[model samples]
Target: MKKNVLRLFVVGLIWLASCSPLTRVLKNPDINEKYQFALEFYENEDYYRAGLVFEDLLPNMAGKAEAENVQFYYSYCQYYQNQFDLAAYYFKQFYDTYRRSDFAEEALYMHAYSNYKATPDYNLDQSNTTKAIETMQDFMNRFPKSSYFEKAGSIINELRGLLEKKAYSIAKQYHRLRRYQAAVIACDNFQKDFPDSELKEEVSFIKMEAQYEYAKASIYTMKIERYEETMEYYYYLVDRYPNSEYMKMAESYFKNTQRELYDLNP
Candidate 1:
């Protein structure tokens, strides 16, 4: 009975505290006391309320010593709530406003990283992906010795891979659809754009296959020249990828093409 009474008493006191002046702080207009309350809410991990409180405090706290802390935590409050757009905006704003602050480096990293989080799949629009790479690279250039340098480089590589995947898929799709001319153009463009891609060997095979198909489909007057072009690409593929997975398929093209060329003269 005594324990139950004690629990009831504690609960009532908590309800009164929350319902009274403490709850009214959010509604209060006094700027100084409000800033203190915002800090208190942040310390307690009430990020939603903290964010609202910080928003209110920002206009009042600007040009004051408390402004830096308010701005810093405001960004974090948005971040903790997974509001990445706002987090990115505020984080960049923080660094821009307080470049000498201790939080500057972290703010910049999070700004770029926040956008990275919002980036969609490779097939989607990649403006955010582009932003991430550019911002991370800028961060690296500006802070070459920064501890985040390695992490930034890793992110840039990951974004680049996403771009490569998109380009590879588009070219491969053209090849698959038997649009040989477009396939040749797309594969060539993909190679130029992503010269370092691991898909280079596969792309080489695609170009060879596309050229062979184009020659076979060409008018009689163009067949000989086109076939010769296909053979040239075949030699290049063979020299570069002797043990390639697509070698068997390429060999089939070579045999067929050779028979046609011989029959053309015969």
Candidate 2:
């Protein structure tokens, strides 16, 4: 019980020690003194405190020489705190306002990078992912020789991979749900969007299967045309992926489609 009481007292003392300086800096009326303390906090990697001080100083420092550094450091504080959306906004604001500053290029790059960091999972909405790619591409275009160019390219490719995965999963999900027509359309869109995807072979096979199923379920008047479409898909699949793992199933689909078409015509 005594040790516990002593520990609690020590913890309280440590908290007060940490908070005391920040409290003093916060209450100080002198702008230059507060700005200096803010930089000290930032240099010490106490970004939370530094951000608080910077936020307070920002409005008062407008049009002053210190405004630029304050804004730049403020953005960094947000980024270091993992506040990516806010970081992206502030970084972009910094670049737009200080295009001629030496840090402008870095600010723009961080703006793109922050968006990249903000991208959601493959299963989630990818509007932010697309925006990240565009911003990174813009960064590369503006700074061709930038040290960050390779990193930006790599990020773009990674985000594209996520998009490809999402698109493929959606197409495959449609097939699994027995939504054949939607599956066929989604498969076609996926192939068109990611012609170089490693999943192209699987997507083609799914398209063939979907077409076959769709034709089988169609009305008498539409059966012949739909089966004919299935046959066309099957031929395309076999022609492109002659040795595919899905070849056996694909050929079965083809034969079924051919038989159906023959019965309809006869």
Candidate 3:
């Protein structure tokens, strides 16, 4: 019975504290005491309340030694509270404003991390993912020997994966939609841009298939030249990826191209 009563009492106190007006702290007569309490709240991980207090304390504590920590945590508060875009902005601000401060490196990383958090799945627009890659690459370049090197490299690769997936999806969509001409160009670009991608064999094969389809769909004057070009692509893919899973399907295109060559020439 006593434990139950104590639990209710604690819950009630938390409710009251959360419902309490933040202005009470902002209007406190002693700003120094108010700032100290804000830091205490942040240390306790009550970041919402801490952020409220920090917001009020920022102007007062500017240029002070404590401001460094306050600014750094303010961005973290934004991050923890799930305001990732704002967190990214403020983290960049912290890095720029206190470039020489010990927190600068972490702030830079957090800026990129905030963007990474905002970056969504493969199907969504990937502008934020692109931004994160750029920002993280810059961070890695600037801090090559920093402890975050491996983690940063991992994030860059992850971002590249998203980009590669999106590019492949779009190119494949062109092929699926029967826009074989566009698919040919898109697939070519994808191969050129990401030659080392795991999707290399698939990409090359699809472009070859697209080229064959484009040739078939072309006018009489264009068919011969396009078919010849497709044969070149088929040989290239077979030469490079003899064991490709796509070889069976790619072989069909090659046979069709060969038969059409004789018919077109004859």
Best candidate, TM-score: 2
- lDDT of candidate 1 over 1-266, digit per residue (tens): 99999999999999888786557887788878898888888999988888988998888886899899999999999998999888999999999999999999999998988888878899888888889888888888878888999999999999999988988888888888999988888888888988878999999999989999999999998998888888988898899899999999999999989998997878
In model 3, what lDDT does residue 63 have? 69
TM per candidate: 0.80, 0.91, 0.86
Ranking by lDDT: 2, 3, 1
Per-model root-mean-square deviation over C-alphas: 6.5, 4.0, 5.9
Query: 1-266, model 2: which lDDT tens digit per residue?
Result: 99999999999998898689888898899999999999999999999999999999999997899999999999999999999999999999999999999999999999999999999999999999999999999999999999999999999999999999999999999999999999999999999999999999999999999999999999999999899898899889889989999999998888888888888889
Off by over 4 Å in 2: 1-19
Lowest summed lDDT window (length 10), candidate 3: 18-27
Tell me the whole-model lDDT of each prediction, alpha carbons only: 0.89, 0.95, 0.90
Query: Which ranges of candidate 1 are over 4 A from the true structure?
Result: 1-23, 215-228, 258-266
Ranking by TM-score: 2, 3, 1
RMSD of candidate 3 to the truth, in angstroms, is 5.9
